[model samples]
Target: MRDILVFLIVFGSIPYILRNPVVGALMWVWISVMSPHTQGWGFATTFPFAYIIAVCTLASLVFTRQPRNLPTAAPVLALLAFTVWMNVTFPFSLYPEYAFPQYTRVMKIMLMTFVVAMVIKSKEDVRRLVWVLVISLGFYGVKGGIFTLRSGGGQRVWGPGATFIGDNNALALALIMVIPLMYYLQQTSTNKWVRRGLTASILLSALAALGSYSRGGLLAIVAMCGFMWLKSRKKLMVGSVLAAVGPALLLFMPQEWASRMDTIDNYQADASAMGRINAWYMAWNLARDRIFGGGFEIYEPATFAAYAPVPNDVHAAHSIYFQVLGEHGFGGLALYLLVGITTWRTAAWIVKNAPKAPGMQWAVEMATMMQTSLMGFAVGGSFLSLTYFDVPYYLMCALVATRVLVQANLPPPAPTMTRPG
Candidate 1:
């Protein structure tokens, strides 16, 4: 019965998992553990669905055939272990209550990273995962579209747990990240039905993003689309036309959606931009003073003290790069870059080498989406602290792991047989 329940949950959650790894992972995190912000209760309060899904996945993995290990797992594991060690040893001062949440977040990411490496062994698995993600995201987009039409499209409407749901910008960013992957899937899928489905999912997700009134999200999507277009001009033209027409016909949205175009302008004035420059200035001065860094998670009070005059509100540098530099110092920053660069380079290499291989294609798609997502995050991180979100970080690690796995599985280049004269 326990095994059956686990199977049911893993299969049931497949739809959501397909749509967005971030959402799926977050759901798992919420369920396996509890969060205080939502109801002051643990898993029972916020993540019932995720809890069930996670338990089932663990059970399924245990019961399934023994999984093969990848070669790159060692380095990735070492880095993660080092990161956790540094966090603990550095004695970064965060609220005691946050300790559990932080730990749980890390664990969830690790779990997802493992899943990405273990489960995505073949092209079929990749296709299944992509379809699931598309369908799930499409469902959300449809839901969001309905809500926008019903509410006359004002502020972004979140379902039950608004606490877990990110703001318009964040949601937009999340959806934007998926767009490239969807496009890649569409291009590679042989089955007409699969291609059609991916197309529909992309359109729906884009509409959902636009409806969210997240200027940042809109910008990110446009940027991703542009990048894809640059890669394939013919596809880009068709996509651009479809994108323009789809939102107009499907839902009644607000004109203010366009206002987000001016979002960059705020940075110019440096006043109403909400203290971004001040934060950057403060971060620089803090870095200068503490050449080694304040410690992981130590950005709040320790660094804030230097900023003076106003009360020191405990906040992160709003950028992952800066956050790493400020908290973990130069060494930590180097590791972060090493992990990122290694994963990225490996993914790119696989894509370039195995253009025709389905697994390779999927890897390319994942790599492209991740790279774009990272870019979006970097831009958005200039104003928001998105690193706390498990999606981007976990996906990056998972892709690296996947690259390692894929490379390890490839048969050694057949030894050129010497001509037997």
Candidate 2:
């Protein structure tokens, strides 16, 4: 029955998608990110629903008469440049067979980002996309948080298989990134019950991240909240509440969790930490010697032997910074970093220049939460390999789109971030 239902939804949406490409794009996101079929105990688990939808959506785009509305923003330009660089490095890739498939996957994600940038033309479109995105990831956040509460954080919180947040560390980072989006939903919701539900979801998501026992996640939440307050117009109030809530959540976690995070202070003794450092060095050396880096599956013993001092101790590039550096080289890493930095500054500009009137409140709040989410991703991502994850890229699409929506009613671009007077 579950399989039938998912199949029906995917099949049913094709005509609508052909009629309205934007709807098709949204449906694609729902299937890709949330992966509802993965939850069911049926044939839907094996169904290639996203593939079918993508085919239909592309057909719709090509055959339909709808105008393609890609926005020109710094973030979007950086993304395009980065995508071009990835393509340029493909032939140079040491492991072309392995790298090409991963390249195709990233290409699909980039396609969706452009589809979103072109399709989402209004503030309401941005809001709806936010809702779908939040629901896609927040479902995991809410479930993980409840699991933590029920099990007393005894076990780890994992994500659906073959998905972005498949492991505990990735799950934690994904949940932390969703925290601000959850807050944005709560703030914009006028319904008391809806707001209350969002509040519970936020708490659960935080608990779930804690339950994942990811030390990087612990650091991320701190940096996320700090940025949340720092960027807010009402920083003092948010800071006070954060200060009170931080300790309470810490005290609620199990002793084992605390012990695990404590290894951050004694990283020299932690095997995992030392391995990550070794991998970082290996990536650095590979990029130094080979401009395009090793491409996909660069952690093999042969590649490591060429660049690593401790070749036998090779591990995957655990850090996003190193992940791109090793897979695509310094040029690729620079383009990747520019996308994030531009998105961050673009979000800042939106927040500052958003209209002062009541009708534009959504734009202000949207920009704030995006900045907070980027803060979580930027800081925590240093320790994780989610450089090509669609979540941040999707969120960046929304931010650039939001800037367009907001700027329609405003005079000009806001001044860049300024130091204290």
Largest lDDT belongs to which candidate? 2
RMSD of 2: 4.3
What is candidate 2's lDDT per residue for 1-421, written digit by digit as tens? 8788888888998889988777888898888888999888988998889888888887787876767767889999999999888888888888788788888888898987788778877777788888888898899999998898898888888998888788789888889988899899998899999999999888889999999999999899989988888877788888888888778888889899999999999999998999889899999999999898888667788887888778888788888999999989999999999999999898888877786433676888888898888888888888888888888988888888888777777755578998998
Collision pairs in model 1: 18-132, 18-133, 19-132, 19-133, 31-51, 34-42, 34-43, 295-327
Q: What are the models' TM-scores?
A: 0.72, 0.94
Model 2, residue 184: displacement in angstroms?
A: 0.7
Worst 10-residue lDDT window, candidate 1 = 31-40
Q: Which stretches of candidate 2 lie over 4 Å from their true place?
A: 356-358, 411-421
Q: How well does candidate 2 score on lDDT at residue 240?
A: 88
Worst 10 residues of 2 by lDDT: 352-361
Clashing pairs in 2: none
